[model samples]
Target: MTTRNIVHLDADRVYWTTEVTYDRFPARQLWALAAPIHELVIPARLRHAAGASRPGDLQHQLVTTFQRRLGNPVLSRLPGQTLLETTGRSSGLPRQTPIGGRRVGQEFWLVSEFGERSQYVRNIQADPRVRLRLHGRWLRGVAHLLPDDDARARLKSLPRLNSTAVQAFGTDLLTIRIDLD
Candidate 1:
């Protein structure tokens, strides 16, 4: 193996196998190397698979897998994760979707990945009245779809990890602001 690869592997082994805490210098150095490794390993095509110019087959498969098999269940159980409840346009029944957002003052803001085509967005159009579960507490709110908002800037202001996913995978982004009660 190359010297660089050997060192990287050794660092990973030390980090995972040993009892070293993340606060230590060695552990911190290992963590610092993780970003570059992650970037290097994921090919550019795969990283930008969900762009508007790209045919969305790979993106569709990944998103479908996460939403059905992973995202829904995990978000439901997580305490601080946000769950949005909207009335189904067709069935007139309550439809709950796990979403990521930031709360500023009395307003909660999120961007829809599929813009107006998203099912939840359609539900919001039918009825602006909604409910949000934030920090393990359910609160009533009014949903407002902001077509004119700068989605890129808004995404930057939200949580980094979720925003990164949204930016990378989102094709047509539409911002939604909830006026919490």
Candidate 2:
């Protein structure tokens, strides 16, 4: 058995590969049956993850819980999903949170569904320096929590489907602007 992780630095892609060899006939037979099931189950769990799909339809506590558990991890790994990476306030570690946003000029804009109460929000407050994975490329930036910015109006400027989801499920909407360097 062998595994390979191919990282294309230029393309910013990670390819997960595994090769399994069964020596015995029974082992091969068992694996043949399991392989098909494996194919179906893996992608299914990934899809079940709110991050892989979208959790916009879910409500407050549910949204937060589901997203924290099932959203960010899968979403952050998606090919083109945007990820916000911040320094953990107390732990002093990098924390990546999947977010919905759009880039305008050199700035990346997003609305926080949880406002200042979100963990990432508090992280931003502690330290504004951050990284954003946009369309597969990592960009260094500084995060700004815009309290006065009209979040609803800001949503209108973002992607329609995501903005609609944010409008539908958001309780405390706050605008966040990341000035990219």
Candidate 3:
């Protein structure tokens, strides 16, 4: 039997651990490990080998919800380690300008790439109050990062940005935690 470890982490540095046996590991395991790390809750139904498909995956949905929203949510770390701000395009449209809002939970995850140093990062360092729009949905939320040492350490380990954009712009890629208010 395959045993999977389930760890739960709360805002106060509290963590719970449990083990689950399964004939075969499911893809959900990847997100399961990260859910707690990111303060997200995974439904029990998804824990099983055959996880149910999310609602937005179906076509003809009029309005997109947080779960359906797409794109790389923009993030910024506040000064004094107080908070981390996330922002992105709300409508998931390429030309549609981003609007101010909180990033829908589970909509996006941190990528290996370090975004180019631009207004987004500069504004984050200057002020903790930041906004983000989703790539293909109309939703947002303003959040402050919870104080967690482990989370901060994880963010620090991300590979530095060395893309052509960074070289051309002469910008440095910085890593910071995501704090929701």
Candidate 4:
């Protein structure tokens, strides 16, 4: 596959264009796998090159878009993952976000990758009351955001795969504890 950017400049206008060419099967398969990463990296790099104040913000946006649009919706339906259902702060609707946490006695603990920037975290801030789907059962709980808690150390206690992501793309990591009933 080959990509070309053609720039045609005139006195009154500038035309910027991108052109892509690929072979029948092999190149198409390669591009299909690469497109997602390319979509994320190119914009992020462009933003960074243009001296954007927060480069991490681009990554956060990309991650959240993936989670909100695709990942969460798919994962929430699966019985295997833990899902936290928070009341939407603005819409007053239920928002279920797939999460990685552990249950200990009467409590459930997890870390928010974006802290209060996360929609569900913001929802929790507005209303501490929430419902968690644990082991295919919904349990009522009161959520608490622990800003002072060591989120890095707390991640160590959570699921490894999720904790790795939280550590990697997380801008403002926050620990959350839920008192389950």
Using TM-score as the measure, the top candidate is 4
- Measured against the true structure, the TM-scores of the candidates, in listed sequence, are 0.66, 0.67, 0.23, 0.78
How does each model score on lDDT? 0.77, 0.81, 0.32, 0.87
lDDT score at residue 86, model 4, on the 0-100 scale = 93
Q: After superposition, how far is residue 164 of candidate 1 from its true place, in Å?
A: 0.4
* Model 1 lDDT, full chain set: 0.77
Instruction: Return whichever of 1 and 2 wins on TM-score.
Output: 2
Candidate 2 Cα deviation (angstroms), residue 112: 0.3
Ranking by lDDT: 4, 2, 1, 3
Q: Rank the candidates by TM-score, best first.
A: 4, 2, 1, 3
Worst 10 residues of 2 by lDDT: 1-10
Which candidate number has the best lDDT?
4
lDDT of 2 by residue, 24-110 (tens): 678777876666555555444445552554343234556776677667778877988989999999999999998899999999999
Off by over 4 Å in 3: 1-117, 138-171
What is the C-alpha lDDT profile of model 4 across 120-174, one tens digit per residue? Answer: 9999999999999999889999999999999999999888999998899899999
Cα lDDT tens digits, model 3, 39-149, are 323332233223544432221121112212432222212221112233333432222212222223542222111222233444444443443334433333332322232
